[model samples]
Target: MATAAQKPLTGAKVFLMLVAFFGLVIGVNVTMMKLAIATLPGTEVDSAYSASLAYEKEIMAAREQAARKWQVEARIQRQGDGGAVVQLEARDANGRPMTGLTFKGTLERPIDKRADLPVELSEVGIGIYRGSASAVAPGQWDLVIEADARGQRMFQSRNRVILN
Candidate 1:
């Protein structure tokens, strides 16, 4: 008897083999993409940190420049009548009178609410603005001055004066 001829590989077998091979290749490609991305350097992260540092420096410089532009020198002089006169010496960046600037003063006694006094800008000198109010008692007083110059609130200072 003649032996049965071995069947040739079918088309379905060849197609399945091709599908499996392509599937494995696709999986390997996906894995390599993930690894490449994971190993990449984070240049954007470093740039963001550097940008924040630059912004902080810019803000600090702006604040410093504003402080330098609008400055106030204040003092309290003892009047001859046992009262203290609060003086605010206002100056611009070039040490000139910031004219047409409004000034407000609040004098509060350390112990008495009845002695709270408010004064406005009454005298404007060459480079000074003066506001005078009588002190009721001889003790510490809080002098709060607010100034507006060139549409900017440039000066706000609190000073303690001892009436002796």
Candidate 2:
């Protein structure tokens, strides 16, 4: 007896398979996108163009600052409690300790907006300044140190620190 002719796969079946595969891929992509948006902090800058516009002026100011040749060294260490301390030493190009300068500092958590801490350093000695913050969580943090000598000498530096 002769068997009936069998029908091969049709175009509709192939098209449906392609659609399902792509639909799965698209579904996964959307899920990941949602999770990223929900967990991560958004917006590094409110106005990039404005910042770029000031780039030239900032460069000039930096050059003016560099001409003074002030050296600033910064350090961060953990305290006995759940806090951290920052120390800074400033010197002129002549390697003499800097004195009688106004200093400011800040500690910022990169991911948490509310974890910002203002630093107030007291001069322990000439060119030596130190400050402490309480209730600092154990993680990586950003530090900005600034020192100004009247209206003349200006110095600013940024560094990253970790607390345990």
Best by TM-score: 2
TM-score of 1: 0.51
For candidate 2, write residues 22-85 as lDDT tens digits.
9999999999999988877666677999999988987887898799898888888887887788
TM-score of 2: 0.69
What do the candidate models score in CA lDDT, each in turn?
Answer: 0.73, 0.84
Clashing pairs in 1: none
Q: 11, model 2: CA deviation in Å?
A: 25
Question: Deviation in angstroms for 111 in model 2?
Answer: 3.1
For candidate 2, list the clashing residue pairs, or say none. none
Model 1 CA RMSD to the hidden true structure, in angstroms:
22.0
Model 2 / residue 154 / CA error / Å: 1.2
Distance from true location, Cα of 57 in model 2, Å: 2.2
Deviating ranges (above 4 Å) for candidate 1: 1-68, 150-152
